[model samples]
Target: MITLKFKKFNIEAYKPGKSRVKKLRKVIKLSANESALGLSPKVKRLISNKKLILDKYPDGKSKDLRKAISKTYNCNFEKIICGAGSDEVIQMICQLFLNPKDEVVLPEYSFLMYRIYSKVVGAKVVFSKEINFKISIKEILKKVNKKTKIVFIANPNNPTGTYLTKKEVLELRKKLNKNILLVIDDAYAEYMKNSDYSSGLNLFKNKDNVFILRTFSKIFGLASLRVGWGYGSKKIIDRLNLIKPPFNVNRIAQLAAVEALKDKKFVNRSIKHNFFYANKIKKFLEKYNIFSNTVSANFLFLNFEKCRYSSNFFYQKLKSKGIILRSTKDGYHINNRLRLTIGSSKENLKFMNTVKGIFD
Candidate 1:
């Protein structure tokens, strides 16, 4: 047999939140930060009523979806590139920008994809320490050097549920070297209602050094569809297009995402639902001495330091009751904490009831 040899890299694969527990047929999953309201009515109707041409390939450029994004966000049409998910866009950015020995910097407890993709492309991943679970711009700046290629940050940061204000983010850009690329993921931007907050696309629309990633997964309720788009300068978009997989986003996902953008009512309703239940859950958890960050995104970073039980103890208890919450030990390496995704009204009620049963 011919010897099989290929390049190998030391990288830990991503472990998603547990979706099942043994012997549980009906489980309430609050692990993944998915849409609380499920799919938009427009998306559901489009999928059911619109006849699709299965044999033919979708538009490689995703023209209609891009148009919808441009119209919805009021951004330049030529500067957008659609991807299978923001994860794919992150991967492409690593591929396009990184070489062996380059550096990528991000918060230590932020989204795992940024570090994972950077490592896959032979880049050195630098971790910036956060201040009390919030990303520190000073710490990020300390890690930057000539070898740094990109800096990735998720606002209303995943898993932590804490965000930086508009002034703070603007300061970060102003202080950083102009040549370094700052990749901002706005996955939960639609869920934000804070007056001091602003999405990356809105802040960096004209900046060539900044790239913004937007997803239809959170408030738009289209995680299963797997369609996301990136915004950057036209030159960068043109270069990215050269390497983007022809027809990266499938036809069904594209159509669904476009329709999802048009349904502002559904988005607003989801936001309202998230705000109500997030505060409700946060306040309820406090009775048991488990605290969380201020309500910013669609989830809460539940800290068990002052609680009667440990994070793992609560996780196992929930699992036994056919409920699931994200364990910070999975890839985050964070101790004494769990990421609690805001769920539907019924799911949230069940979670609180289960917590009471265990504590009472």
Candidate 2:
């Protein structure tokens, strides 16, 4: 048996939403931060057209889709690389950069994938302390040293939905050494309406050491397709390409993502719906004396401190009632908190009604 060295690392505990929902005949899943609005009709048609190409191998270079993304973002084609998902892109970055004992820095309460990938690459993972679920730049700066190879900042961070301001991002970028690779994971960038929110792509234009990561999973409603891309200087992109497997992304995913990018109407509608439903859920949570941060993303993090139930207990209770939510513990400490995905109006109402029953 070929055993991995880090076999002892405990897999992050995720709330068992899928298995729990299997037992419930009628389950409303609001756990994973997937877009509740379905994929665009154009993308569906593109997939239908590409079904015939399944017998052939995918384009090894993904040239056309790369061009599409490059054109959309107004960046050079040499600076972009597509992957199975943003997760795959992250893994590639780790493989290309991290040695056995190099250090990786990120916020304590951010996305779980950052930690998972760091360990997979045999890097020493150091977490900066979080303040109200947001990344504190001072804490991050304190943790940085000569050993730090890469630093990941998930803007509008997962679970918490907190983001860094443009000024904060620039300040951090300036303070970091030129050799350190700063990856700005903008997986939820599309949902942000604030003009001051740094997209990370701006850093790429100014600094050779910066890279911006994005995904089609959220705003484009193509989570199942798993299309992700990154933008950086040609040097960094070329380095990442060294470890990326040929044809890492599939044909259908490329086609769907290309079409989805062109579907501006669908993108607009999804953004509009996200803003509308997020406010509704916030108001509902407030009525129950439950407080949550006002996030500029498609998901809401509901802290259950006022309800007197542990997050795990509340998650189980919600699951039993046919409402699925994400629960975290151990490394991810939000006290008693549940991350809820904003869904369609009907789905949102169903989730709200189910929660109201629990509170009442």
Candidate 3:
């Protein structure tokens, strides 16, 4: 048998929860930050009509989808590139920009994909310290060096639900070297309606060194479809396109994403539901002395301070009750914090009631 010398990377320390629910058991899944409202009806219709085309190969150019995305954003078509998901785009970024000895900078409690992708390209990973589970700009600035090649920022950051204001981001960008690539991951941008907060697209337009990464996973409810795109200068996109595999995006995903983009009604409804239920959850938690920041995203970062059990213990308890939530401890070092995705009013109520019984 032929064997390669590449050893598997042990990056993400995922803790598998034991499932207590048996077949036919009803359970609420609020662990992953998925759009609980479900996918767009337009996507469903498109997928149904395109089922017969699966036998054929996908369009290598992804021209129509690119056009749709560019038209929606009012950007150049050449500057937009789609991938299987934003995760794939992250991997492609590492492959394109990182060298064996180059260093990558990210926040300590940020997304795990940044570190994983950096390591895949043999780049050294440097982490900035977390202040209340939020990335400190000062810490990031201190870590920057001549050897650093790329910096990743997740706005309305995952797991923490904390985001930097537009002013803060622009100030940070000013401090960084123009040579270093700054990636702003805006996976939850659609849910944010703050006037002070930008999706990083403004930075992309103003600075050639910056790029914005977006996803259909959260707001568009296309997580299962694996559709994501990135925007940057035409020069940067051209370089990325050189290494991107032909037909990187499949047919169904391209069609579904196009339809999902036009489903403004579904998008608005999902955002409204997220905003309403997130506030409800926050209010419910506040009565018990547990507090979270007022985030502009679909999820809430629940703190376990003054709770009877540790975060892991509480996680297990919640899991035993058929309630699943995302915990940040193993690789993230965010102890006593749980990231809860905002679900429907009923789902949110169920989660709140379950927590009330355990904590009260």
Model 3 deviation from the true structure expressed as Cα RMSD, one decimal place: 2.2
Candidate 1 has an lDDT of 0.93
Q: Per lDDT, what order, best first? A: 1, 3, 2
Best by lDDT: 1
Residue by residue across 84-185, what tens digits does model 1's lDDT show? 988888888899999989999999988999989998889999999999999999999999999998999999899899999999999999999999999999
CA lDDT scores, all candidates in order = 0.93, 0.83, 0.84
Query: In angstroms, how far off is 202's CA in candidate 3?
Result: 3.3
**Runs in model 3 with CA error above 4 Å?**
1-4, 7-10, 13-24
Please, what are the lDDT tens digits per residue for candidate 3 over residues 1-360? 997797655476544322235542877778779987989888887788834488789887678989988888777788888998898888888999998879999998778889988987789999999787777889999999999999999998987899999988998888898899999998998899888998787556656789889898899998888889888888888989999988899988988888888989999999889888888888888786667878579888878786556778878777788888877765667778887888877888888899889887
Alpha-carbon lDDT of model 2: 0.83
Top candidate, metric TM-score: 1
> How many Å off is the CA of 244 in candidate 1?
0.4
Cα deviation at 349, candidate 2, in Å, is 0.7
Residue pairs whose backbone atoms clash in candidate 3 = none
Candidate 1 regions off by >4 Å? none
Error of 3 at 183 (Å): 0.3
RMSD for each model, in Å, please? 1.0, 2.3, 2.2
